[model samples]
Target chain A: MNIFARIGYAVMTVLAQLGRLALFTGKALAAIVSPPIYFRLILTQMMRIGYFSLPVVGLTAFFMGGVLALQIYLGGNRFGAEAIVPQVVVLGITRELGPVIAGLMIAGRVAAAIAAEIGTMKVTEQIDALTTLATNPIKYLVAPRIVAAVISMPILTLIGDSIGVLGGYIVSVYSLDFNGSAYLKNTADFLHSDDVTSGLIKAAVFGFIVALMGCYNGFHSKGGAQGVGNATTYAVVSSSILILAADYVLTALLFHK
Target chain B: MSTPKIQLIGVKKRFGSKVVLDGVDLTIEPSSSLVIIGGSGTGKSVTIKSILGIIRPDEGTILVDGEDITHINGAARDRVMRKFGMLFQGAALFDSLPVWENVAFGLIQGRGMNRAKARDIAIQKLAKVGLTEDVAFLSPSELSGGMQKRVGLARAIAADPEIIFFDEPTTGLDPIMADIINDLIVSTVKDVGATALSITHDMTSARKISDKIAMLYGGKIIWQGPTAAIDSSGNPYVDQFIHGKAEGPIKMAVKA
Candidate 1:
């Protein structure tokens, strides 16, 4: 085939796949609205996917905020604006750095784990077993993960933002030779509630995307060990890319205000 | 004398252009064992998967308890599944869960029984399968191949399912271990009074366990009769399969 034919075929193939995915998504949504919610399963998954993820997110945010503060001090000093460290740090962490960093980290950890767990289940016919047992696999498996990710991500982002801000605060007050009160005032002045809100909203959306990609990849996974490994790799890579893309779009829309 | 526990009528399934099953029909009587013998790629697994609704048939019906479950969904599917237990080709135990949890998976996860109660039943099932209580605390990966199959069997009967499916259950184990598992399956099925449907290439297993034996070739059953009559079924395909001879009506589908 010529270039035009090749391009057209690729586009058609992608369209076909997307249509199938949409249909599957509709089935999932239907399963969601149906009775027998499995609240206990949701709570169990929340503990595993969300609550347990705190330490890594906190540690990453703390160091990221600290390092960001130091970088801004050096960069701003070149322009005789070292005093802007706190304002820059707070805006950067609250609006961009905190959610994006925490999101990327979680996309790697949670996505891979969910894919592997579900993939193993798929290969062994446990998922099929559930279906035979008359349990809606969507409600029992997919819904819990999706709900947990959506609810837990915002909380994780909130905690991460606090730790990130504190990390910047420590650096600004100690190493940057700035008055603590002035630093606090600039941070408060530069950042509004919208910036923080947008970041948290992005975190929740990213969480859904992360969990969705993981479950989608793993649930459809084929072969055996290699198929599961591929699902894990695809989950992490795809979710990370999607997070970055989403961050840009959300930022452009939010910052336009 | 009772109605067949499972009846697959004119079942047809195709994957794209490749037809996996072409108008297949089968029946398994209650408390009786049926073994489907076929080659590796001749759709033995597809036949089982179709009955379970894991792979939907393009045409025909799968009936359990005289009810068609082929196109069924939702709570009805689960209700049907509760009556069925399966021992997969591999043990297929959840590695993250302890041995007892894996055994009690159906009881705890599907039925929502208390873990303590589920754990006690799991130990009993494990003991029935010849594993001790201490072995229940270990992970599935910690167990050997034979041990895992035993664990898988334990899980299958955990809920006292009315029917059981075993897929190549004896293929990977040593001869003695395979026979041991086969015997366990025979005794357990009898003990629980469960109908059994199995597929395997092992004629020894087929002859030992099944009262009725069917040979699947070219996506259809070529011959099916009592196990005692298999040797004299006089069908070339059945003769080739049970005798393990390659130079008859059965031809290997090698790429070369």
Candidate 2:
């Protein structure tokens, strides 16, 4: 009976949290559509979440792409299909690795930052100050971040895809003794517009998850500095897990046909 | 007689099983200052927060200018909020913005005033609080505690609001600084011709800044009167509190 009661409590807690997130998301969407949209704040967040993230995303994509080519070459050697390296690299990057890697990286960087800053503001009563100043914290703080993340993630993922294929080209031509132009031709030929667009779509959803989780945890944070620390950790962990889970669901939906 | 500038009737707020404000009733006339004094964890802050619409009361109506604003929100709430300015306990200035920008936030964001005009008004308000124009460009983190409080005061009065609230405006300052802040509070409230509500445990500040004083204990205002009459109120709780006596009816919740 005790175990059953505990399990029931845990389930109830999870459902309560989900319900809260749904409400928060709904409010955020409403704020996004309403007047008094903060274009300046949105632009600043774009620079922080997207532009500053380019180096890390580009580097991660490059290395992952190089490793993918090597692994596919080794696996193909075993099956006597080494010529399929370019096709697999481009497909893997555009369809899966690029969006997922960029999402996780941003989940670590932007989500943690948003949570810590907002959590501090919450503890310090700056949010209440915002209210006293006649500004909606959701419109002024949360909406800009959500809009920025949704807009920037796809652009970042697109750039990341190109860099990743370039990485595969580098490894194949320089190290694996394949002609560069042929590797490029195979990557371009096998990579359809559908694959790239699908990754971009996944990237946008992941971005929304990152910002929303960050703002939600931060807003609910209490108990001062330790609580802010907890909020930051929760934001990163939850967004990372959600990104991976969402990637799988998106992939299934996009490729099932 | 005339509609009280602010009124709270039978206000109640509870957190889970712990009831903070069982039923708080209070009134403040126009262009007056009322200071609510209570021990920490009492409902003084809750009462003010309820009036500010920061915390919605579970069972009561709050009226400002004879309008029931207890449950109003969105544009209507924003409209009511425009009449208020609050000086928080910790000065709660935005760290991301400069001092002038913090002061001008309500003007620029809430009223849609342009930067140049807002900047001019912000500097003037800062000067009113004894802050120099050069101090306007510095970040809030650069200011000392008293300066921050002054800046917070400047921000609160920047838009010449009709009502102002001070939440422990003198907490965490030196004695001299606290006295200075109390003086500033009195002068600024006068300057704006605004109804003022303040919550603090500091008796000295309460007496110095308020025309009337209220004592809150156990989630209710136990005794209230003009500042001169608080000393003779005769309510043991009020007497014990103002005199800072531990050996009275009010028991300290100290754990062994």
Candidate 3:
């Protein structure tokens, strides 16, 4: 094919994929609000997406906060601003790092799992089985994951934020020889409510993106085992990219001032 | 006479450039076993999916009980689906649920039956398929292929559906097991008085279970007759397929 033809084909392919994703998102959201809600399934997914995810998110956030404090201390030492560690760490953790880190972790864990599971079901004709059994695949499979992720991310982010701040406090007081009481006072005084709420809002949007990408890729998977593997990989890649992109957009809108 | 139980008129489906079903028309009578015989990739599964509203035909009208169900959605679609029970090629039981739950899935999820009641009916259906009560609590993955097929058969008959579709019911079973399944299919279908539509390349299973046979070739039903008359179909493709011949009017797509 000529260069122009190749370019046109690429554009069309991207547009087609975008269109499919949009349609899938619309259907999943509709299923979420419609009747015949499966509370049991939703609760089951919460345990998987939220509760099971706590340890990983907590560990990452703690280490991230400790590293951020150390880096700030090193940078601030040159400018005679070492005391700025607590304030900067709290600001960064509550506003950005906590939610984004937790989001990425869950995307890696939950999104890949959902994609592989559903994609296998598709290849094995279990999804078709569900249809023949009078169960809507979107309502039975996709909606629960999406709803669970949406409800879970914000809560996970809140816990991650607290753990991260505590990590910074530990590093600041014990390692950096700072006064523990004064560091706590500084972190509390420096952090604002908007910082925490904005991060949570970002978490919710990231959660939606993760579940949507997972379901979309899995539902459209074809062939067999190889196809399911590809779906799982794509779910993680697309959701991670989307999470980062959404973070920037949400950050601009939420903290523009 | 009674709207033929199920009807497909000019059903056509295409995936990309390849046409799977091209203007195929069929009528399945009530309380009769009709088996569609064809080679792999012959649109046999697509035909059943089209009738079940899983894959909508690009152009066609599908009627169930004389009512057009080609484009029904939501609750109406669910109601239409409640009339069908399908046994997939690989049994397709949900690995997440145990054997009994797989059988009772439709009753509890589709019809809102209490779990205890659904479980009772599930066990009864399993018993009808020659499965004992001990197999009910086991996961589908724990069962052998023949046992899984039995569980699939039990699930199909669990709801006492008006129409049952078997997609290659005996594809991977041994001859003895396959014959046993064929007998169970014929007897249980008769017991429930349900219209049975099965698709298979297995000539023995087809000949054993079906009262009538339809041969599909080149995306169309080329010949259909009573099972006894299949030998005298006089169509080269039907003869080639039924007799398992390599050299015939219907050429296999083999790469040299």
TM, chain A, every candidate = 0.93, 0.97, 0.99
The 10-residue segment with the lowest total lDDT in model 2 chain B = B247-256
Task: Give the per-residue lDDT of model 2 (tens digit) for B67-122.
Answer: 99999998899999999999999999999999999999999999999999999999
**Candidate 1, which segments miss by more than 4 Å at Cα?**
A1-5, A30-35, A38-44, A74-81, A252-257
Among residues 3 or more apart in sequence or in different chains, the pairs in candidate 2 whose N, CA or C atoms overlap within 3 Å are none
Per-model TM values vs. the true structure: 0.93, 0.98, 0.98
**Tens-digit lDDT track of model 1 for A72-103:** 98998899988788888888888898889888
Candidate 3 structure quality by residue, lDDT tens digits, A1-257: 89999999999999999999989999999999998899899999999999999999999999999999999999999999999999999889989999999999988998999999999999999999999999999999999999999999999999999999989888888899999999999998988899899999999999999989999999999899999999999999999999999999999998787
lDDT of 1 by residue, B1-256 (tens): 6778999999988887888799899988889999999888888999998888888999989999899899987777777888988898887777768999888878876788899999999999999989999999999999999999999999889999899999998998999999999999999999999999999999889888889999898889888999999999989888888888979988898731
Identify the superior model by DockQ, candidate 2 or candidate 3: 3
What DockQ, on C-alphas, does every prediction get? 0.51, 0.89, 0.90
Runs in model 2 lying further than 4 Å from the true structure: A1-4, B254-256
The stretch of ten residues in a row with the least summed lDDT in candidate 3 chain B is B247-256
Task: Give me the TM-scores of chain B across the candidates.
Answer: 0.98, 0.98, 0.98
